[model samples]
Target: MAPIDLNLLTALDALLAERSVTGAARRMGLSVSAMSRTLTRLRTATGDPLLVQAGRSLVPTPYAETLAERVHAVAQEARAVLGPASQAIDPLSLERTFTIRANEGFVALFAPAIITAIQQAAPHVRLRFAPKPDKAATPLRDGMIDLEIGTAGASAPEMRTQLLFRDRFVGVARRDHPLFAGPVTAERYAACAHVAASRRGAWTGPVDEGLHALGLRRRVIAIVPGFLDALAIARQSDLIALVPRSCCHRGGVATEGLQSFDLPVPTPELAICVMWHPRLDADPAHRWLRQKLMALCRMPA
Candidate 1:
């Protein structure tokens, strides 16, 4: 079967409303001859003389009058479809799972705030937090994860990102560690055994580089996969754990049991960001999630 030409509906609707060939042509940015030919096609399609001359003016036939309102409605809907898109996300009515892939430290740090905020706004929405084992973009590109939060490394150049906050590494250990007895100088900080957080376990990291600047190095007795594990070891033993101050949490407080002391030597500050594929940049639900995450992150720390 031959497909129906949608443009013909617009011409019929306009010609019926205006009741003048010249007027319909002007409204459609076409000449009178072009509109007359369109009217001929419309007549053949509908098998009716949709518009007839009434002296110097044009009048709509009974069939044209019957289809006027419906055609106009269809034309309006088509125009909207061709125009700019809309954001009609209804959070309260939405029910879907949003997968977020992030490092263990980030999930431990930011998940509570994000969960609370999302739950309060959208009761039915579910959050799936996936652990990021490495820096790769395949999950995002393939839609396995709705969002990825962490430092935007060289992984996903095509992803869109919004900076959430800046974080710096801090030395943390048991409350009664001897480093608290005096100033945490490079020598004192380097003398203690440390727990290094390296998923790949190569040994050297930001803290080591900072110590290198002072011609000092700490003994990394053990290498762990994540900061939380290192913190757990440091909490029980005398091992020193270097972790991001932003991710350390205590009950009802931003910085608690963790003793955050400025690094004796310089270390690069890392920016925390929320990243997602550019394809979802304008998606209403994705936009809501991004906005909620950004707002929740801005809360006083």
Candidate 2:
């Protein structure tokens, strides 16, 4: 058999993705005739009509559909392999900005350490923290955000994820609050007025469900958009703030003027993960930043 040209893989990937000769031509910067000729070569090479016309638009054959994801991954991997050499990326000399999407509580708890570490190791590099209004994958796909720190619920299947750490909800209140007068119980906890934190403005979650199971319900007097805000409200007032354990504690040190306690009812543990698009898998600097974050989160506090 004659040796196959590696360039054909690039053309085949574009053709399969676009499903149109004209589109493939535009994507690969080739003329329509050239793309059509390339498609002919692809047919002979694969021994299958990768795409077939069904109506106005072209549709992939069963075989072509199976090849789409694999081919796309291969093409992306090749590009990364051919990109700037990994040896050239020295953190101390590198100058680039990476944006991370996360909630204010995580920012308050972890950002200081992360920034300090990065500054000492890579003074020329910069970090940008973006507010995470939702776990939508568009920002990562579009390169608007480099990393996202949060749970992986409903995450895109193709995106890559790494477990950073686990957390649980803990109730907090002002120091010397009335609730501390005796042993805390489910009934007394539910009787207290609460201030809930939810980015979507929801006032109920696992805690409410747990309370319901025991024929109890807490009074939510107000709702805020973030845990940080909820903590502030709890600190100055009598309302209880249920937030992640990490947010109000660092190195076993609780936030001043606030007393933390585990909820009386059982709740699920939160598995926090750092997610990113697969396209950044082979980028050395991105990999470095990811490792740094994972290490920091794993440290005893």
Candidate 3:
């Protein structure tokens, strides 16, 4: 038996990623003919067709799709192993920006603490908070986001994560609202006009689920995209808003005109987390950032 050709692995990963031989060739700066030969070599070496033509396009075989990510990861790891050791990070001397993608509520709740902590240790470092309109990791994979803070969703298995905090839902309205003056029941809570926070614009959520379980439903008069928007409308109107207790206590939301009460039904508690690409798992600066965040998160309630 012959030893595996390590160079071919890079070619294989690239080919699988692009599917098309010509596209992969352009990516690797090889001519179409050269890429075709490499693809032939790959098929012989792996004993898989890897990619098959479909009309004018090429598509990866199921096996090839499965290997694509792993192959890319393996090649990156090998490169890191052969490369020079990562240099020690100088917090004070470092001058770089880290972009964080998060929902509006999370940013309002945690950004100040994170920014202050980073500034205290690394004065030259800058932080950019970007809006996360949906649960997608494309920004992280593309190197646009240095970190993400939210409830863990369908993330790539290779991504790394750490729990930040646990938050439960709370019903909020104006401070002097009639609901605040009496024992709030499920029926009473459901009777009020509600402001729903539906990122996808759907007027339903865990609150609705809990209400459904109790054979009750709230009268949602308006649907907003984020917690901040919901809270804003609730503060000025008679509408009730279901908000995360932790978020409600954040600087922006924890203001006059807001009064929060426990939801009458048991709702799921969201486990907030910080996520990053596995490639940055061992980076000194990234490690430092994660540490600061973890420490802040662990502070007494």
RMSD to the true structure for each prediction, in A, is: 3.9, 14.4, 15.9
Mind giving the per-residue lDDT tens digits that candidate 3 earns over 1-301? 7887776887887888787888888988999999999999999988999899899988899998889889999988877887886868889998888888888887777778888988999999999999888778888899999889888665666789899888889888999898877889998999889999988888887888888988998888899998888888888989999888886677464546788889998898888889999888888888888888889876754
- Please state the error at residue 171 of candidate 3 in Å: 0.6
Tens digits of per-residue lDDT for model 1 on 1-301?
8998989989988898899999999999999999999999999999999899889998999888899999999999998988777888789998989999888877777788889889989999999999888878999999999998888574578889899888888888888888889999999999999999988996877978878867898888999998888888887888888888775642234334556678787788888889999999988898999999988887766
Candidate 1 — what's its lDDT? 0.85
Better of 1 and 3 by TM-score: 1
User: What lDDT would each prediction earn against the true structure?
Assistant: 0.85, 0.88, 0.85
- Per-residue lDDT tens digits for candidate 2, residues 155-257, read 6888899999999999999889999998789999999999999888887977988899999999999999988888888988999999888876662233678
Give the residue spans of candidate 1 off by over 4 A: 1-5, 13-35, 43-77, 249-257
> Which runs in model 3 stand beyond 4 Å of their true positions?
1-87, 252-254
> For candidate 1, which ten residues in a row score worst on lDDT?
249-258
Rank order by TM-score, top first?
1, 2, 3
Point out the worst 10-residue segment of candidate 3 by lDDT.
247-256
